[model samples]
Target: MPVAEPPAQPPTTRTTPISPSTPASPVRAAVVGTGGIVTGSHLPALRELHGRVRLVAAVDTDPARLTAFRDLAGDDVHGYGDLDEMLAAERPDLVLLGTPPALHAVQATAALRAGAWVLCEKPLCLSLAEYDAIAAAEGTEEGGTGGPYASVVFQHRYGSGAVHARELLRSGELGRPLVAHCQTTWYRDRAYYSVPWRGRWATEGGGPTMGHGIHQMDLLLHLLGDWTEVRAMAGRLVHDVESEDVSTALVQFADGTMATVVNSVLSPDEVSRIRIDCADATVELTHLYGHSNDDWAYTPAVHARDDERRTAHWRTPAADVPSSHAAQLDGFLDAMEKGVRPPGSGTEARRTLEFLAALYKSAFTGRPVGAGEIGPDDPYYHAMHGNHPDWAPKEQ
Candidate 1:
């Protein structure tokens, strides 16, 4: 994988005029931290929103990266080196926090406090403390007449296939889930970890687990509901880093369901897969490089439910599930417009982050770390303060 460093300072502002064909009321969204994934994943997704979302401003430490964003976003896309300054100046309807996972809490809190609806990138945060802090900053009750909104970016959950899968589970088509399996495999070359923050404990956080596995884990938690406990192990088997390059966990959900997850950055080819075993049958969904629930295969010993009723419940067509990022983005805007709750709020994001933190604690202490074990006072809470808990290095 090729890793390029972001440039420094804000570039010239740019804007592309909205036409009559565009949405009647466009939501102005400012993007903070236009480096790495922000450029690759977020920018493309934002573009797909068409007129509903306008790129009004951007904040980043790198000037060249800001210029690149401006070039693609348009002339009206204001650039700022300081996030607070940009928020005060542009006063965008929404703010997208594209910084590293470790910084998610602070950035998200600031954005919300500044009265801009925020859409934070995935993993919610890197540590449990960060999760708690963000959660504490949230206001679920109508935001007190006029207040900033908040939503996390778990695009995979918003997909048509994922939604359909959830409906099937709810409909008892798969019975009660007894087990689940998740695999998140991708290759990250040495060059990919060459960035200043990459593979570092103080900045990038964990390697594959936090950086890549989080997406799959988010899906797992969403599908399985709450977890009771987890036993896990992690090791830096391939990548040169302070964090694990490969990790696995044994997760037990509150419903007495069990699951196993394997996340790695050493696989030659990328694959994201999940399998759920219910009492009456099994439902499996698999895809490489992305998620598509329409391709899922539901194998039941027999169609326990009425065929007509099951068919009628299918909300998504058989076609490929579109990008969940777009749906998630639209969801946030809708929440803002309707004065209701966003689909992926910071409080919801806290659960996933807490789960990840517990996994780390369990792996390090060689004991099961329950949900409440990691709280605001723990030293490793809120992203381990960008520290790598003591772990033995693999033998050379």
Candidate 2:
């Protein structure tokens, strides 16, 4: 696919922040795709912030699904069979995309060009090139601090536990992070792959690495900062699928932290987990799908256990906010209200996407892949598979 030309630069003037004394109008919002994610996650999130955002439109190719969504969204919401039509008619200020992974780049580019902000689902695009193109569409060259930016829905980063942990790590309160482990082990039987897009490279991107484990991996990166290199291995052990059902990687962070990452869909006993061992404390979060304050624990090192003040600081609780679509949406809405680029957008999101590409490259090539190595000229920059390895399952 040809890259989209960057849209005309808009005014760089910042909008005044929304204040309680001078209330601002609700943001006009539209949602694309009426799949399970739309109904189960995005819709409920929008409803939670009804006073701040109005669901002006919804789009879906499936007529039955569209009608069902419209019924649930009420008569005030407009429904469209096509995304372009909905964008032209509603001209929403925000576009929430719950579409398939293959469609994110095109849809997000379209919404950005239409002068709307976008909050898209995971595996934001197919490759690094696609991510760069979307960044360009967000007016990055003209300074990306203003309107019409795109943010990905890495909801795990917005939870209170994550927020607090990040602060401690950033402030050196937890000391230097030494060793870490991130896991996204969830079971998916053959029946789950029956969905045409579930296991295909062209459609679903990669296997559990891109689709399932990305959430926890993203959170790991969020707390650990940039990664320098990845040495990985992957295999299609159980299910008959084009992509690997299990992948394991040893990642090196720029901060001198070495970590292990595992993404799998073959584990019968399922869980999502991340553990970071710092000089002074060990921080661990274990949960499935989402996490909360209760799921996080902080343990002081043996030497520091005697220091009551230090231990208390590490254990202090922040407000209990679980990792959820709603929490992330609130952050996005805050950014929109302030007329600034939101978290999980542009380069920040690209980091996670790039890390995934590196993992795949390392797995397929049987070598370490480094940061900033895959550029426009690299095959992996255009597609995750790059030079397809013989070990990868042949597409049937």
Number of the predicted model whose lDDT against the real structure is largest: 2
Predictions in order: lDDT: 0.72, 0.86
lDDT of 1 by residue, 9-38 (tens): 332222221122238768778888887677
Q: Estimate, for each residue in 1-396, the C-alpha lDDT of model 2 and write its tens digit.
A: 111122334322122323321126788889999889999999999999888888988888888888888888877788788777777767678899998899999999998887788999998898998998898887432332476788999999987888999999999998899999999999999899999887888888889999999999999999999999999999888888888899999999999999999999989999999999999999999999888899989999999999997778776376798889999998888887666778998778999999999999998899999999999898889888885834575334
Minimal lDDT window, size 10, model 2 = 13-22
lDDT of 2: 0.86
Q: Give RMSD to native, each candidate.
A: 5.8, 4.9
Best by TM-score: 2
Q: Which stretches of candidate 1 lie over 4 Å from their true place?
A: 1-22, 143-147, 302-316, 384-388
TM-score of 1: 0.86
